[model samples]
Target: MTDDKSKRDFRDRNRVAGDEEYEVGYFASKFGLSIPQVRELIARHGNDREALEREAKALGVR
Candidate 1:
């Protein structure tokens, strides 16, 4: 089955663990933060996927 838009939305917003698609450096650069900082945020807060996109809209990650 195909992933729904909601799932895609969630993944885009999330910075979830177990996601090996992204390297630490990649996340850092995109978020404009240090690698450790990105790691810490993801570790502590985990990810919502959709929330991240919203956050990006607010913070302008794109």
Candidate 2:
């Protein structure tokens, strides 16, 4: 369902490879989410860590 452009956008925005805060396991644990869930969050939320955390909290996650 995801297009290549969207995949590129996710990667470019999230920058997870070198950013420890955005790493799958770390982000997932921080938000009490699975890795895939974290990835989906990043994709949907444009990879802003603070914003994602706020959104998660607002959504009653954890």
Query: For residues 1-62, what per-residue lDDT tens digits would candidate 1 score against the true structure?
Result: 33354553454444444244355566657767665665655665466545543453455443
Q: How many clashes does each candidate structure show, in the order listed?
A: 4, 0
Error (Å) of candidate 2 at residue 4 is: 26
Evaluate residue 43 in candidate 1 and report its C-alpha lDDT on the 0 to 100 scale: 62
Each candidate structure's TM-score, on Cα atoms with residue i matched to residue i, is 0.43, 0.54
Clashing pairs in model 1? Answer: 10-49, 10-50, 13-49, 14-49
Query: Candidate 1, 54: how far from true, in Å?
Result: 5.8
Poorest 10 consecutive residues of model 2 by lDDT? Answer: 13-22
Clashing pairs in 2: none
After superposition, the stretches of candidate 2 with alpha carbons farther than 4 Å from their true spots are 1-22
RMSD of each: 7.0, 8.1
Compute the lDDT for candidate 1.
0.53
| Residue lDDT tens for model 2, 1-62 | 22355344454453443234446687677767777677667778766667777766765544
